[model samples]
Target: MKAEGLKIILSGPSGSGKGTIVRELIKKEHFILSVSATTRLPRQGEQDGVHYFFKTKEEFETMIKDDELLEYAQFCDNYYGTPKTFIEESVKNGKDVILEIEVQGALQVKAIYPEALFVFVMPPTLTELENRLVGRNTETPAVIAQRLARAKEEVAFYKEYDYVVINDSLEEAICDIETIVAAEKLRSSRFKQEIEKVWNA
Candidate 1:
């Protein structure tokens, strides 16, 4: 079985239901959501250290230089990264840390934690993704176009991940993710040492 503190990655196109799935999973499951640090201006209702830890570009650069970030990248002139310290502490506290990072960041995590579960969430179709993006009512038309283009590029990297989950139905997608977590908890690698302990005891 997998350990109590596994790092799970959820990635997909911008309009895909990955965020919704992640939110529901957090509400129902035992996992810690890893908030990202960003140099970009937060949109409406986006809180610092919650949605993202808002920082200046210089601060972000310093963190990178200090190797305080596990993985980081600049997109659309904004820098976003995950800090390593909180993730380590979360695991030590027996909480599985779920990182909703970009595909590139997920690749970096693969190198460091190959056993980490990689989930590639896709929408029902590209058309559906477009519709969802429009429905958000947050981005301008120009921003929507840019995001759509970026999503197309991002979705192409889905093959690099271990699992592909289609977010056609919210309930179904959430169920699949829950199932994956449950199965991961039963992995031989996770339970082998503990199995011996149980028998020896």
Candidate 2:
């Protein structure tokens, strides 16, 4: 019997390099990065299904009311959520689905999918995190300050996750996540059918 794929919830603060790690993981692993649905309008050159499943505020609210969203959160006056059907179908078909979301939404998923693996990425130091934010040169000084303060608050939630990977080295961080996925695939709970077949034989 084939083992079912794992549902992985990967989350981190703004400057933790989680996005970069996810991109690398996709290249090396048989994983599908879940596309999120958002109420925000598409920016220039953004596609509906590829970038985000764009929806009107009314439609998004209806989904929430109907329990179609696995997890949803409001950010910058816009609703962003994981559609339940896509993830359920992908995992059932033996595809490891990675949901890269913010900590708030990740915790919401934890409540609904307790069996899912939750991994939190962290920077080596808060100062380093600040530096990375500053290095971007995209955000203003006020925005960077806000992000740094939020990063400190997010650090406290590390204890809530099953695994915390300190992303001091990008290569090392990716390796650690890959290791986690490989070990999780071998977990006894994930091989119930194989175990039963051998025992019955």
Give per-model TM-scores.
Answer: 0.76, 0.86
| Candidate 2, 79-140: lDDT as tens digits | 99889988888889988899997888778888899999999999999889989999999999
Query: How many collisions per candidate?
Result: 4, 0
Give the Cα lDDT of each candidate: 0.85, 0.90
lDDT of 1 by residue, 1-201 (tens): 336777888999887888888888788546779978899999999988778889999999999999999888899999988888878788767787899878887888889878888999999888898899999999999999998899899988988888889999999998898788778777887878789988989
CA lDDT for candidate 2? 0.90
Best by TM-score: 2
Candidate 1: C-alpha lDDT: 0.85
Highest lDDT: give the candidate number. 2
Model 1 spans with C-alpha error above 4 angstroms: 37-66, 73-80, 137-143, 197-201
For model 1 the TM-score comes to: 0.76
